[model samples]
Target: MQRIDRFTRRSLLKSLGVGAGLLPMLEVEYAQAQVPAPRCAFIFCWPNGMLSTSAATGWPAPSATAAGITFKAFQASLEPLRDDLLLLDGIDYRFLRDSRAPENTGHACNPGMLTGALFKAPGTGTSSIVAGGASIDQYIGSSLVNLGYRGLPSLNLGVFVKSTGRLSWRAAGDAVIPATDPYRVFDEIFKGVPASGGTGTPTPDPTVTRNRSMKKSILDTVRKDLTRFNLRVGTEDRKRIEAHLSSIRALELELDRQAMPPVVVGSKPVLPPGVNTAISENFESTTNMMIDIAVAAMAADVTRVVVLQLGDQGNANVILSTLGYKPAGQVGNTGNFNGHHAIAHRNAADKDKVDTWFQS
Candidate 1:
């Protein structure tokens, strides 16, 4: 009986071919299995408005003499991406234009831009107004979830936007609040994966037993097998394996850095101290950070759809000076246009300049 048992075990081990030693190679193969890249949709919403002109500006105009459209100077920046660009002209949101409040057109149009429904304005004022239905992004995101998207359905990110000014709505009155902090967004996207060099194992002090001992034994064997396999692999294969391992290590290091608390400099911290406060209050930096996080989340398959609201319509406080433009003074008969919102309401020249900067 003992001899028969020994023979059975030996046959099983040989059948496995390298037995436990094959685990490392299997691990590498499993890691290399190409997960089909997730299909992504990104909606970038900007505030105020855009320039619509057929003249010196880059805006395209329907040709009077020719069959095709004519592009102007302002669109020169978009020349490289001209093939990919889709220009939709004369498409107006009739809902906003014909809404109940004719006086508060901009405010009403902000929430209704993506939703395609009139804003449900509160009896009191515009402060409590909300979208009348789910926005397009939300509908697409929900549909994707139903179609078996395993990751987060959507990521709503915004800069200088309030809940009232949100572009994505889940329902008539349900506004999806965005994560304003870049660090928090980063942490949320990478919450589950183990940090670099972290044992990722809970303390075994209280539950240490024979089972734990067996697990340790198996892990030690796996490590030894990995080392032996590494020695036998060719230079090219070794390099590939090393590169993957290095990527894993780098990811861990980044996680560790993100987890670290802000370093104090003199009286205040170098980074934003409050979780509520944005990582950077500067419009440019905040927009860039949100975009970076959105890209990272999409690449990691954390979310298939992302709606990035650059600024709220009413409160789009973009510092025009940063774009090398002095505040709009009276141009011929135009009045003083102080801020972005004011400039947007000015003559076509001012609006076109702002729009060009935004396009760039």
Candidate 2:
């Protein structure tokens, strides 16, 4: 869970030969200096309305919060994932009402989920103000770029949706589109920058090559500049530049890593023929595939940050069948019980059905 904290900038720099045996001395001197370390990706996804009682476990033991949302038996599906998840409750998005749009609008939270901007138009038709700004993923990507991340810093992925909403407002609060297709997304990641040793036919675009060359030129210039400043600047300023150089080199390595194309997760694994894209045929397979992809992205270190929308607003219903609750015969006897959307409605009234659902 805390894998992100395992590596610090100072330690990473020390490993890269910044100073000879100077780390321990510095560590003793300034043990609490705030260093600019690599920020991992933050993934956020809420496809359907959460069945508070069914999805979340209540306060500790028997009587914690007393009357807040609690996890009922129905949340068994999430049990395996609980440790990796933080099930927050009682948090309301009331700040969204500041907009002039009519209050209590349709699927209002969808637009505001990442942007934190109020939707100003009616929710009917395409009348909503859409998202007022870039979503969190986009903001991080843009900031990384400004901080000198030239390669893809963030990845927004979804199925059956345009990449637009993947990005929230970053440039003047506009939407930053997401990348939907795995194939296309993979290509974009490897588009520029040929394979190491210039052995591949995937030649980078001339413009892209020029841009990279220019970046190299700037780094060269900065290195020269730092040399000059070393003679003129104070000791503290020199240390700062050294730190910056260490960070820059780390970033360069990261960029190179990002440039390498990701092989399909199971490329080397033996699989039955015709098993490719099994998740695309229907809901169950697709959800499994999405989860698989998310996990793969993490294991591959392909942008530590990610956000997965199960589906658009009201789209969680689309997955109800996948869970074996709707569309009988679609998933054998398992997926035929009841619609996933109905589970919440049932939980609101009949407790017996819920207990049975969990126990059965």
Candidate 3:
């Protein structure tokens, strides 16, 4: 096999007319490429679970042949890429089911769904809960890093807030908080990429280089001060100071790395202007922006693992009124459903509609 680096692989894919939107169709072809192609794992997580009660509920009906599985009716949104979809059924996180109290099952399942482990029991007087181990995405990302893949270990992108139910965990208690801001994510991943029309060995912008040097110098000074200050502080304070210093050092290293010339494959993507990077009131727009950034990051080979948390379990903030669905109503009274979580718990019909919207 040809040992192609990340840039070469990306260039080859682009030359073959590959684009971010066509990623699903090209997945298999990428794996079979003669060059050592990049391998990406995407985890798209949604809350409230799917309506898998039966074929009538929009779940893929059981089929004797591969051609028989169909994304129809409620699953019509997936029709365009039905051939690329992989539908798995009859899977459960037994450990989570066994360990969680019956009352906590719904929310508790969120963390365990991806990690496949029970949630850690909170200590007395503590309300926090965490996954028992690293989630599958993180596990795969760490393995890829160990195999010498450079760039970010993983990209956790989400439209939800940090307080939302997390699906990606770095460890038993460490939830990987996603970056909700699309511009920030793009900056973090693609800022160093060479601009279009540049020569093969693109010159580092003097302003960028100077800014990085200044940041590194500032961090170095802060680290030295923290080291001297540590001796005067108590154990707990000293530990905190050390942790802060460690983060500074990491940032310094990242700055140094970014100062080096980027491995350009082809023309870099133009940053989308006027994008609302901050969390937006419009959920759909925010989500689309995040998806765009995630796709671009993968295309640039910035990260091979991406975990997208679509929404949190029991979150009532997402409003689907714009999607043309009738507002969720109470048992009898007619009104827009209070929120997504309320609609989710109303009945199977509501859940199916919401799930289908998400899949779409």
What lDDT would each prediction earn against the true structure?
0.54, 0.43, 0.59
Report the Cα lDDT for candidate 3: 0.59
lDDT of 3 by residue, 1-360 (tens): 011223322233235331221233223122122455566766677666666664546556666555676656765666665556545444444554564433355665666655555455555211255666676666666576567666566788887654746777766656777788776666655565665533244456666677778888888898899999999999988866866775575456546555665444444445557755343235666777677666656655566677777766655556665465443444332223545666766766667666766777
How does each model score on TM-score? 0.58, 0.50, 0.68
In model 2, which regions exceed 4 Å deviation? 1-39, 55-87, 104-106, 121-127, 160-167, 171-173, 183-281, 328-360
Best of the candidates, TM-score: 3
Residues 1-360 of candidate 1: C-alpha lDDT, one tens digit per residue: 001112222233234332211111111111222545545677777776665552544446544333254456655665554444444344455665555555566655767766656555557566566677677666666677567655565788887676566777766656777777776665555444333322232122222333344555665565556566778899976864564444334333333333332211111112343433332125666666677667655644456678788766654345455465545454332233445666776646767766766665
Q: What are the per-residue Cα lDDT tens digits for candidate 2 across 16-51?
A: 332211111111111122343333554545333444
Model 2 is weakest, by summed lDDT over 10 consecutive residues, at 20-29
Local lDDT at 189 for model 3: 54
Off by over 4 Å in 1: 1-37, 54-58, 62-85, 97-103, 191-281, 325-337, 348-350
RMSD of each: 22.9, 14.9, 9.3
Better of 2 and 3 by lDDT: 3
